[model samples]
Target: MWPRMDGIRVLELGTPGELRTELTELTLSGAKTATAGLPALDYDAEREAVEHVGERLVLVDDSGMRAGEVEVTRVELVPFGEVGWEFARAEGEGYTSVGHWRESHRRYWEGQGCEVGDDTTIVCLWFRLV
Candidate 1:
C-alpha cells in the first residue's frame, strides 16, 4: 500500500530517482496535470482503489516529502493503444505523439516487470494542482 500524509493518499510518480524528481517537479510547477498507470499491476496488486473524481491527494517527492496537493478531475480506463494525444499532452512529459507516449510507457512498464501490450488496460487520470 502507498503511504498517506495527513489522512490523504500520496501521489508518488515513478520510482525514487531522477525520473521521480523530474516528474514531481513538473507536477509542482503545474506542468503535469495527468498520469497513467496499470490498474492490474498498480491497484489490484497493491490492493488500492482507483482514484475518483474530486479526490484530493498529497503529491510526494522521492524522499516521501509532500510537495503539494492535487485534486482529481477525471479518470478513465483506456486500452494502451487507444490512449490519445490529449491525454498524452496532459502528462506534460513532452511526448511528441501518442505513439511516442505509448513506446515510452511500454518500455517503462516492461522494465518494471509488467507486461504491456496494445490491449493492456491503462488508468488515465487527470488532476490539477491544488
Candidate 2:
C-alpha cells in the first residue's frame, strides 16, 4: 500500500484477479479516491513526492495472516525504484523469475493444512521511515 503525499493510501494486493476487491470496497465505503490495480497509481507523482520526503519507503505485508494475529516473521523494508530493482534482481532473483513458486509454496504449505487461495496477495503498504 503506497500512501501518497496527500495521505491517499494505495494498497496493492498482488492476487491472480481482483483480490483487492475487499480492500477497495472497504475504502469506497468512506476512504474515498480508493482504487484497485497498479495502473491507477501515478508512479511519477509518487516519485516526486517521495523525493521531497525521502528516498526510502517501508512496505508492510499483512495479507495472509488474520487480523491481530501474532507476527512471527521479521519485517524488512526495501528501497524501491532503480535501487530496489537492482537489489531484487541481484539478491532476490527468484522473485524476478516468474515460475511456479507460488504454486509450489502453496502445495508445500497445503500439506500442513495451510491453504493459500488461488491468488496470492502481495500487500505493499508504502510509508515513510521517518
Candidate 3:
C-alpha cells in the first residue's frame, strides 16, 4: 500500500530519483498541472481509488517527504492514442509534439514492463497546487 499523510493520499511522481525531483519541481513551480497514470497498474493493482474532481492529495518529493498539496480538478480515462495535445502540454515535460509525448511514454511504460498499445487506457489526471 502507498503511504498517506494526515489521511490524504500521497502523490509521488515518476520514481524516487532524478525523475521524481524534476517532476516535483515542475509541480511546485506551477509548470505542471497534470499527470498520467496507468489505471491497471496504479489503481486497480494497488487497490487504490482513482483520483476524482476536488480530491486533495499530498505531493511528495523523491525522498517521500511532503513538498506541497494539490487538488484534483479533473480525471479522464483516455485511450493512449486519443490523448490530446492540450493535456500533453499541461504535463510540462516540454514535448515538442504529441508524437514525442506518445513515444516517450511508450518507452517509459514499456520499460516498466507493461505492454502498451494504442488501446491502452491512460488515467489523465489534472490537478492544481494548493
Candidate 4:
C-alpha cells in the first residue's frame, strides 16, 4: 500500500488530467525530481516551513493522493525574471527555455488571482525522490 500522508503537509505536484498523471509517473519512475512554485502567502513563514534542506516533502497528485516523498536538496528564492534556465529545465515541465517558464508561470499565477511581476519572488525547491 502507498504510505499515507496523513498529517504531513502535501504539495500538489501534478496539474489536472493527463499531465497530472504524467508528472506523478515521472516522480514514481525517478525522472522528475525538482519543482518550483509561487505561493501566494507570507514569504518568510512559508519559506521557513518548506525551504529546509534534507526535509521531506510529501508530493500529491491532482486528487490529493500521496504519491511519494522527496528530500529537499536545495532551495532558492529569486525574482521571476531572475530564474536561471538550468533550474527552469529542472522543472521538467517541457519548457524549452526560461522564457517559456516565465510565460507559463505568469499565466498560472494570474489565473490564481495573483499578480506576476518581474520582481515577484518564487520559491524554487530542488529535491530528490525519497
- lDDT agreement with native, every candidate: 0.94, 0.29, 0.93, 0.74
Which residue pairs of candidate 2 clash? 1-124, 1-125, 1-126
- Tell me the spans in candidate 1 whose CA falls farther than 4 Å from its real position: none
Evaluate residue 63 in candidate 4 and report its C-alpha lDDT on the 0 to 100 scale: 78
Quality of model 1 by C-alpha lDDT: 0.94
Taking all chains together, each candidate's TM-score versus the true structure is: 0.98, 0.21, 0.98, 0.80
* Tens-digit lDDT track of model 1 for 4-115: 8998989999888999999999998888999999987789998999999999999998988889899999999999999999999999999999999999999999988998
Off by over 4 Å in 2: 4-54, 64-88, 95-130
The number of clashing residue pairs in model 2 is 3
Which has the higher lDDT value, candidate number 2 or candidate number 4? 4
Give Cα distance to truth, residue 49, candidate 2, Å.
2.7
lDDT, candidate 3, equals 0.93
Error of 4 at 11 (Å): 2.2
Clashing pairs in 3: none
Weakest 10 consecutive residues of candidate 4 by summed lDDT: 41-50
In terms of lDDT, model 4 sits at 0.74
Model 3 deviation from native, Cα RMSD in Å:
0.7
Instruction: Kindly list the per-residue Cα lDDT of model 2 for residues 13-125, writing each as its tens digit.
Output: 33323534443333234331211112113233255322212233222233432111111121222222112332222222144432343444345445634455534332122
